[model samples]
Target: MTDTAQYQHFNVFLAHEDHKSEPYHKYLKASANYETYELKSSLEVDGILYVKVPKTSQPTWAKFAKSLTNSSIDELQNNSSSAVLIIRAPKATMAVTFGYGRHLLDMECFVTDFGIKTALNTLNHDTLRSVDVITLDEQGVQKKSQASRSSNVGVFGIDISKDLLRGVTGSSKAGVGLFNISGSGTTFSFGKKIKVKDMPALVERIYSYYQSNDYKDSFAWVDNIRRLEEKKDIEPLNKKLIDEISKTNPNIVISIPEMLDWDTITGFSFTRTKRNIKPTIDSSDYYSSLDKDNLSIDSLKRDRLFVFDSSDEDPEYKLYDCLYFEIKGSEKTYILFSGTWYEIADSFVETINKLLAEIDITSLEFPEVYTWQETSGKGKVVEKIETEGDYNERAALEKNYYVLDKKLVKSSRTTTSIELCDLLTKDQQFIHVKHRKGGSAGLSHLFAQGNVAAEIMLGDRKFRVAARSVIRNKVSKDIVETVPLEKLDSTKVEIVFLILGENSSTLKGNLPFFSKVNLTKAYENLRQKGFKVTIGGVDKVVKPMP
Candidate 1:
């Protein structure tokens, strides 16, 4: 806890599965390009460093502090730099890492999450510092929390403790790409500061604790989590995602990622729109080297974004901000969230599917009369989609559904414009049709739009006045006779979201996981407002196979 115990603040690492047999130095390399380090732990080298000697980086600001003009600053300040140190226990397979040496080891060579398990083994009132967690969802969140104070700090966050915990690394945070990973019982990280007169003793204690299995299940309530990066664990998962990105498909979506968990931070106000998410359009702009075989996390550090408004202070984001990818294999479904890929648990996926089934999205058969033509891009894949205006007009003429697509009416309530619906029917079904291409983000926008239009139509009289005028004059006066505006019953107004796509199947299985969250929220709100809500799907027109 003091300067006397310089090695006190260190991270404990367990050798990756079967990596225990390898020489201690084999697991990590010295970061200095032109230098080499003796892999053994020499007590002379800061009592823990594996390098031949203690290599303290010279702080660039040290010169200014020692200058003749103003040379009175007592303590020398050092900016962050990395140094490698690893101490392996003579008894078992454990490595004690000090300084920034944790970065030098390959993720495949050792396990980092055991540190959390060690924290739980501490006495109930012992000094526990912080906890990190990753959510086992497609959102791929990583969060570091110090919710507990020194005295009240137990094994977990008591009031904040919930279930569904897992272990993962490689997050896409806003500035440093921190994925909002989820918590307690089992955390992504757990640590407490303690003095160690000898480094080997600390290694033995951890190795014994892991080997004993006594306290292992003493916190069995917290073992609901598992780590995948212990040994070559993430390679296969990364392989699947890389394949999708190298090609083009919904399996991988590379766009501007929204910032997460900034709302809870106490410093300043932050909004999603405050910093525009720059889409990672072309990968070549960030880097010329595209590794098809291996992934280098450092490459992403160079890929940054600076286009936040000059006048406004905001979270600095990277160009390769965040990525979302999902793949259904022969057995389990895998989701790549943030920068880490996790295997979706079978029970978890089933639980979600069961919940989704109860949501009751009405699937009315849509009229399939449209055709697609080669307007741009690839062969049959890049066919120009029929616009909403064209689709509604044709549907009205050919099928008798009233076209209300572009009848934009300025609302007095919101002081903004509102489009009632794309098509209206005699039975009071107000349908909103949209082309499904932007993945979940596009669908979320549509759901929100549909929900708002329904709210405006039902709640606001002025919105209805503008809606009535636009429908009567712009859309059709005769159509209003069937569904009168003066006595528009909220119950009879059916809000339908007709999503058109060539490959999407019935808006259920193919719907991105995150979109389902938005869809459920919109659906519940509309239903609570006493309006009938239904999800409708139509096949998009695609170029005929030659």
Candidate 2:
């Protein structure tokens, strides 16, 4: 055979069929066309293993039975690992339970790799390729397959090693802990001493985390288990859920903080409002590599935020409730939940007012503030107009200042406030933010300032304006607050741009060149200039001559 055909990798399926064609059996068979095999002397295959586990093994299976009674689940089986070897395919992979029966004295082995190999006389070779490996709990069922953990769910076989828990939260010998934490604020706290029924789900979560080496953020998962003992709501743990959590930006990640703000009204003051929104902001002056990469709507999902825009079928229609939050100690932020923009903005202002009025801020000098920016419409992913001289362009400027031409200045009228609103219109949409405790040092303070670069094609001709950032006591400032209202003279400006809307096919006109910029890049450019900015218009549209 040719080299390509002579040496090739094959996905392997290993399953125990003691319960007939139940879920596990069907799962494997349907996933990869896995055929059954037997360990008898007459039946053999080069690289496949299908075990039929006899009825006698079922009881033992729930206890600590590892592999099939024979070397195979079916009539054909292979014992060696070769080019074509057994492996858990992505789809067939799951969190499984492994432990000795509750009644088995001195037979306390878990279904770890060591235990599995010993039972089947096999080896699990390490392969660099990423693949899914589903394992079962000793209960002969899946942990995530259950509906809820509040109703006396049993875990069968699984125990957390005291040493492991100690290393994570510095809690030593804290008793075999089990918890159930749900989104609905229900909680069950079991301090060690776990039972078989409470062991499966816990063990599965731990094992999955261990196998994936994704143990860093086990707090949330462990918290879910902790709530189980207290008869509280339980957040379901599964591969899919874990994957979503893992995808968010970790450097600046933080748990949702409890609201502590209580204050009065008008503009951006914590004195008139309470802090109800929780979001994580950049810890440093600039963006980290991880934060930069995940600014996309796709990554926002991991942050518990869903962002989407309307389609051709519904332009003015919104999909869900939108929530907005601003990072307290960082540069102001404009976040939109994927929902109706106007409604979210109104609720945001009201919630902040109520929250502030409820807290004690006598000693706390609230650093940053959040308020609703009047936006034009409700849409997914809204922000202020983009402009040049944002955070990304900070490194590009030779000095602290940049120049804007007079033509780009247009009229003297411009929105001087850095805060603006953008709306998201998708279900389950929210933003996670972590801000500095309470000080100006906490704000990212990134900003953008610019005048119209050139006049738009009112019908045809282009007109230029002057606007850009200039050194204000050595720090870059883009706004010309004192400019003449009739004919502003802007020497420094931050150029704002947008991208073409996805539904512009029917519009019989050309879009402005400034409309094609990406949001993150645009914001970064303005921030570099030391001009705080907010963005809007996820897709692009005609710019109003503000």
Candidate 3:
């Protein structure tokens, strides 16, 4: 993408949900005259913004206020701004408009619950603000604003232009300067993007800071000056005003506006701290916008962070629920979330195949594995070992013997053998078994047929002979038949097979040559028959310790 294609817009708002309910509150009070809250998005405009309002209300303006307050129920919402209006374009790009309450909202409003709420809506092309006109200089600072009242419009305007609104500015070359709204007194700064009536001194001060060597500390000092302005108890200082007047440079006094049209080229510039980090494999980053439908997965893949709000069309991808990333070269990316770091070190093939469809990635490589263990519950590993129908098919063909000839291996490996396991050699019977680590394997069963519809086993088995050919008694009708293997006094041992498709009671003694077993019921019966039995399933029966 070109530099102009990368320019982003944002809008700031100033109002929370309570602003609608408690408009009289001091926090909701308008200490300043202009809006300071900012909203951000990358969506184009479409006509017909869907507006919602409360069912009961008093006045239309109050309703307007209420609608504006509650308008956040649309597609995108945040506690920072009152609402976000996104304009969808035909080319899949977007023109976003941010709305702010006209008053005391300030710069540096951290996203907090009690801050504000932004609503999402639609707008006609005429109503949309392209925000493309706003530009921060090489030092990441926006041009100065003309508003007085010590309202740092420069900061807010830069934020609003860079973070919110977008559009082309009207030119001022001719003697008759063109303005969007009707008025000669309305100050103009960088064309249509900003107005600068009161910020000439502030701009000069900022420019002086730029010329100085300790720019960082100077900028910090300017921020302190704003803090002093925000303090209502103290009288406004004339000393600072006098210091600003001493500057003799006309270039600094005359706030010359830059002309930028909607088609002007612009790009975003990010400055990073000089901190070195060793790359690790398997860590990935994700970046997404709070706007939906306009979600550019490609941008998210590049930025490595996802943004969202309540008004978003579908917030599924928001909240960092599940994000996948691909790394490039040998350098690794670390993902820090929920107070823990996860390495994105999967093999290149594995990572690419899974995340490739979701993002536009390049030069990404495979990541190495990083061990992570869950702190609370039993973290179990339930992996399906891919098979080419090898041992599974071998077990079904055998009969009369435990075809599954295996020993139990715990995570902390100490093997235990089961008796009669070698009986598989006698009748060619087979079974497959593996231990359930981390947590109880819960109720599980193996089936022989193509589909599993077998009764397999039940925890209780014994009340048989009642569900026989007749239903003699109501209470006895529901009972099933079962008996302990040890209690069976028969002269010969019946070969009880747990067929996959056959229910325990469905056999009805047919083909009595081989006994049908209800392993679940049999185990329960054995427990009732004075034997300590806890084998829920034969997969990996854990015997009770002696």
Top of the candidates by TM-score: 1
Q: Is candidate 2 or candidate 3 better by TM-score?
A: 2
Give lDDT: candidate 2, residue 85: 18
- Per-candidate TM-score against the hidden true structure: 0.54, 0.21, 0.16
Evaluate candidate 3 by giving its C-alpha RMSD to the native, one decimal: 29.7
Which of the two candidates, 1 or 3, achieves a greater lDDT against the reference? 1
Stretch of 10 with least lDDT, candidate 1: 262-271
lDDT of 2 by residue, 412-460 (tens): 3443321111110111111111122211111111111221111120111
Comparison by TM-score, 1 against 3, better one: 1
Candidate 3, residue 12: the lDDT equals 22
Q: lDDT of all the models against the reference?
A: 0.53, 0.22, 0.22
Task: Identify the candidate with maximal lDDT.
Answer: 1
The lowest-lDDT stretch of 10 consecutive residues in candidate 3 is: 113-122
Q: What is the clash tally of candidate 1?
A: 16
Tens-digit per-residue lDDT, 373-403, candidate 1: 4322233222234555666787777667888
Worst 10 residues of 2 by lDDT: 161-170
Candidate 1's C-alpha runs over 4 A off are 1-8, 30-48, 51-99, 112-231, 236-332, 335-340, 359-365, 374-382, 396-430, 448-493, 502-507, 512-532, 541-546
Q: Give the per-residue lDDT of model 3 (tens digit) for 69-102.
A: 7454333323343322222222221111333332
lDDT of 2 at 327: 20
